[model samples]
Target: MTVESAILLLPWIALVALDRRALAGDVELSTLIEPIAARPVPGEYRTSIAYYRAVLALRAKDARSARALLDAVPRPLPRKRHAEAFEYLGALLDVVEGATERTLASAAAHEHGPRRASWLAVRAHAQAASGDVESARATLRMLRALRDPQLDLASVARWELPASRLASELMRGEEHPFR
Candidate 1:
């Protein structure tokens, strides 16, 4: 291809790369949120963008924004992977929105998927938030014991790590005395 052709393709190539990174839960993708959101996402990539934004909003404790973003995702997501991610992130949002049952159920159901670590972390959050401290501590112990090499929770669900830690400390009565 000519230099001009390559130049024209650069943006598209970048979008594809970013979309894959987003799917793989690359935390760095969060830095590109503004630029990506400002550009017009092609239909093929719209769901990924929506998912990324929704997850970001959830991490920031902005449930309203998260819900809006998730709702924008097309029903019957464009791909199976996207659908799985949608369900997982939606369950997280439900918990953040004060409905934790779905997250607990999702964590139990997807016990061995690639997202198992994330599921456990969110389950712990749900249990702790709902005043089930003992269950939350047990879930956190399970989360800590898991030896899965694929436990890259920060990439996909950025909130889980902190949420898990907070739940653990709260349950153990070890929270820092200072705010």
Candidate 2:
């Protein structure tokens, strides 16, 4: 609403508009880390940066580091981002814990819309990881059954639209413990 605020937000908007994912993997996390850390709490800017950082850690097969970022997205993310934060957090933590009932239940508690789809994908992967093929297949089928055109839109396409991404990742031998 003011010149100073507009100036402050200009860079953040540009940073988001340019597609940070285009940045090369080898660009040195240090270069971009400071900017992401400088964002304030509870907005899309902060959550998105944190999620991207977590994704990078996951890409390196470093769940421990990713966990720290995922965990910081607020325990109850103010309703707007609540489902996503919990979905990623639950799936990651459950996989780390060997997909036990406790973790699955926790993940299930926050499940919503595609968040449920993502959670199921993680659950199925965990089941397969634990040698429960039949269970995994069942869960996978359930996720597939929920498929719809809505997922193609950007509003629902957060991180490759969880369910589809998780399915493809599983098939491609990519280890995305969570979407």
Candidate 3:
């Protein structure tokens, strides 16, 4: 791979490693992310690295850190899809950090392709966060009905990973929404 592409992979690899450790309940996710956070991000990879770090911070329930990291990602990322992903991550953070109406509205506007399931997940999370358990459950049903295996962190398109992970977390609760 080219140097630029290679540089981008660092955060993805660290994220994957964090995911594994998180699943195993073996170590503090923050600890696993420290080394990565300590490194100087390359200019070409700055936005992508910030995005990944935001994802990691969100996973660790560190919304303040996630917000700062995400805010550091420059507008109009290198690719259109990357910009879209940034928007979605921002919406997800809205849900997590308390701003359901806006997030729900954002999620409502998307209804096709990889975005469909991912937005549905955001909708569900927003509903759950807003104390609308019934609506959240229904939204989860719609997301589940999609039955798209790609709507999972392990196999999802890179941009959709956060939403997929959110969906899985909501699904895992089965009898309820969120942990």
Ranking by lDDT: 1, 3, 2
List lDDT for all candidates, in order: 0.66, 0.52, 0.62
TM-score of 2: 0.55
On TM-score, the leading prediction is 1
Estimate the TM-score of every prediction: 0.70, 0.55, 0.66
Candidate 3 colliding pairs: none
- Please identify model 2 stretches exceeding 4 Å from their true place: 1-44, 73-79, 97-99, 110-114, 149-179
Rank ordering of all candidates by TM-score, starting from the highest: 1, 3, 2
Candidate number that wins on TM-score, 2 or 3:
3
Which pairs clash in model 1? Answer: none
Tally clashing residue pairs in candidate 3: 0
RMSD of 3: 6.7
Candidate 1: residue 116 lDDT (0-100): 80
Compose the digit string of candidate 2's lDDT tens values, residues 126-165.
6655666566656765665777332211212133322334
